[model samples]
Target: MNSHYDVVIIGGGMVGASLAMALKNTALKVAVIEPYPIPDARGEGYQPSYDARSTALSWGSRLVYQQLGLWEKLSEHVTPIKKIHVSDRGRFGATRLAAKDYHVEALGYVVPNEWIGMTLISALKTEPNVDFICPARVEGLKRSEQSTCITLSKQNPETGEYDLEPQSVTANLVVIADGGRSETCQKLGIEIQTESYGQHALVTNVTTSKHHGYEAFERFTENGPMAMLPLGESDGASVGCTDARCALVWTLPEDEIDAVMAMPDAEFMALLQTRFGYRLGKIEQVGTRHHYPLKLSQAAEQVRAGIVVVGNAAHALHPVAGQGYNLALRGVVALAELVSEAAGKGENIGALPVLQRYINGRYADQDKTILFSDKITRLFGDTSAGVGLLRDMGLVGLDILPGAKRLFARQAMGLGGTEAKISS
Candidate 1:
């Protein structure tokens, strides 16, 4: 609604909302432009369905949210991951990581994506300087030395079309966190370098006969790696639902995904039980299944003169290691700190130098995470007996080796690489 702003974030998803939260109480005037309005879950009451999607938040991410003053509320719905079990399916090597051994309360936490979005969006209502503009999208961009001008197209309620606004908004900086597929990013001449894994991830929630015990499992098969992260339980009592619920990311080859997706619940569960084993007992009940092609996507350029891309728009890693969102959250905190400091000094927050600073600091961490996820996917994907044997041996070595597991665990927990701290 304002004609100009200090910062205009292009996407209102978790990353953008978090940046807004971090910048709260700062002097800068911020705005978040969102095409999708927050889903209103008020009418029928909240019900945690087995079909719900969950996100894994590393231990380092916990510190960031705590800094944003959201952990107290997020703690209510999240389940702490006490241990991580990494094993090569049907192989002799397996490794286990426990939080207590590392002197941390948890390795990570899993929370439903819906819960995170709702919490962040709802909390934005009280932010005096951060304004949320929903049901709107960017159509045009014109950048200059001083600022960038954005053309807005308001969504039409009656016809579900967009009506362009005659007046545009100007901002000292434009932060794009729209997602992997962003038309605005392309329009700005930023290129995304993507390496396709030629694999698809079958995502769903399942109820096991036994409690999950707050453990996460990463089982590598010949074809791909599949992960079953512990989700605490259903929000309310549901038919045939038990206390042990988990979020499953079963990666499969592209050729076999269609057939697998079409299989009956019983057949699917049987197949999953065979592949995953009964570590948590039986896969008793399953929820709706969704699938997405897996790939490694990175923006060739993350910062421009007055624009910065964060989150999935910048880089989307394979869910094999669950590093995508955690990496993006670190970027969010870094950008907020830099922007706040620039604002305090009355400097141009969107200057190329300021934006480049963010990229400079985050490049190594991004490289490590992207490589780690890709290597895991490729390493486990090899069906050759030689590679498989070596991989198994590596797992065994990881288990017994000194400091190897700790370093690996630190990377998984988003605590490695250059540290990005919020400047208060």
Candidate 2:
């Protein structure tokens, strides 16, 4: 194998794979260093499974996948979100958005994360200029006048530790997409600034008595905000109901989740029905439940000479608004676009100025999204009666105003804001 490459990505998850796919057929030779296995020579394809985890992909993100030629496979298992209902529980005011009002086929789609990751990886397997370095980690890095050198280590299968010494390689540019709490970012002196939201999100998929009818619900209560996103019908055995399944993300106060999570399934379903109301009718069943604290996180420095950060490695937003992944998708596309253009011009793609160009195009959009998600999180998460009334009125005003609704819809769809200016 070559000792060096034009570009090397530190992660091979969805965002990393997307960038690799976007840069394919170009002149740049690229390598992806991932700690997880990459399906190569195995001829792997995505298999539909029951009770699989899923993600919500915005309309703007769909365009990016289309550009990269992965949507056809993705669309097969996705459910379109045609209507969204945002409301404060027991309040008279609410905001409603519909795809028909926006003149689009659908507001967004909910697809399994497994399907997305598998599809992206499967597509990249056959690319001529791409190489997958699996079960590897960036143990150390040294920067020179023109590039960065990285030492690799292999993870032990049983111990799951990066204990095996491996070869070192250099790259003109190193893109980090490992995650928000990336060890690579730490080694490179990039700090993650985070504000805790004092809330934890409980997630699971549920089968209901009634079909979701392609509608998504974001309902706020004294506990916290909960979203019931529509899921597509793939197989009756997968979720027990072919036409009546929805993914649930329920936010609760920090102290209350453990007791709630410990409740039996029947008790949990009853409590969920009580809080979420009968919108989906009776909650028949729930898959495995998981929990995580909500926090607003950002990297202090997204770009520097010879290195760049992308995906959750760069920023993480509150999930209720569903902007985190979409924001990262745009970043992936913008970086790929700028990198390709710079490589074509024979410029130093890793130079501080070159990498800063990507950040410049990304800043406005990034700021707006961070603020937007924070606004939603803080406003609805408040428990004060005063703030509750104000939140209800805000929802009412949003519903009454056409321009405001359109603008908000555009932002939610991932098409509005200056972030789109970032060479996508």
Candidate 3:
């Protein structure tokens, strides 16, 4: 194994893997350190970030993937979201945003996390300038004047235990793209601002009696906001059933999650139908349900000497707007461009000035994205009469006004603000 490289990225999830891909054709040598083993065909292995969760990819995200030459491979597996219907449950205010209104083919695409992981892992394996350090953990990270020193322990293939002895890898730059709960950032004394939403998101796939027509629904109920993203048809049966399914993201109060999860299938479907209404028709079937607590967290410092943080390591926003991964990918694109420029100039990629440039370029977008997600979570989650009335008026205005709809669509599509080539 090489002892030195131009870049060492900690974490091989979507963001980190995408970074490696973005820099693959560049002159810099890159290594990705991931603790989890590569998932097998069944996806039953130990990758943390790759699960059954569905991700809503904005149009900007599609452009990013298209630039990376990954869109063709991924397009077949994704279901297009042609329209988004936003409404307040039992309220008169409802707004509809259509792809035609924005002069686009689709608003976004819905894809499973597992498929994305597999595709990225396969792509990274073929990159000549990239190295995969799977089943390996970073024990320690030290930043020096010249480079960042990383101590890693490789796991034993037979027993899945890390070796007693550790090896060191030194790189001109260390990029951290690990998820929100990053031990690496904590070890480096990077403080993060965090706020708990006192809510949990229940996720699952469900079959509807009627076709979804490639439309996404965001219905705000008294309990919380619930979203039904059209999945079209099921590609492969999960939990021993196959039907027209849509991915459901139901946000509920912390105390009510257990009771909801414990309900019988019929009872649960009934509850969902009641809350979600009959827009998509009856909830005929639901697969296994999973729940995770929601929070807003962002690293206080995104860049330091010899190191830069991206993805969830830098900011993990509420999923209300599905902006977390999109924002992370934009940051990855900006950082990659800056690093490539630095490498071309024969400058130290990890130098404070170089890293600061990346940070400066991304600060405004990050701030806006974080606040957008946070405000949506707070505003829609509140069921108070005053707030509801205000939100209803906002929704009505958004529907009636073309300019307002266009602005909201641009933001949702991640095309607002200073446009980057990667997001073009």
Best by TM-score: 3
TM-score of each: 0.95, 0.94, 0.96
Sort the candidates on lDDT, descending order. Answer: 3, 1, 2
Candidate 3 lDDT by residue in tens digits, 282-371: 789899999999888889999999989889889888777888899998888888889999999999999999998899888888888888
Q: Write the per-residue lDDT of candidate 1 for residues 375-414, one digit (tens) a residue.
A: 9888889888899899989999999986998899989888
lDDT of 2: 0.85
What clash count goes with each model? 0, 0, 0
CA displacement after TM-score superposition, residue 245 of candidate 1 (Å) = 1.2
Candidate 3 at 30: error in angstroms? Answer: 0.5
lDDT of the candidates, in the order given: 0.85, 0.85, 0.88
User: RMSD per prediction, one decimal?
Assistant: 2.7, 2.9, 1.9
Model 1 alpha-carbon miss at residue 101, Å: 0.5
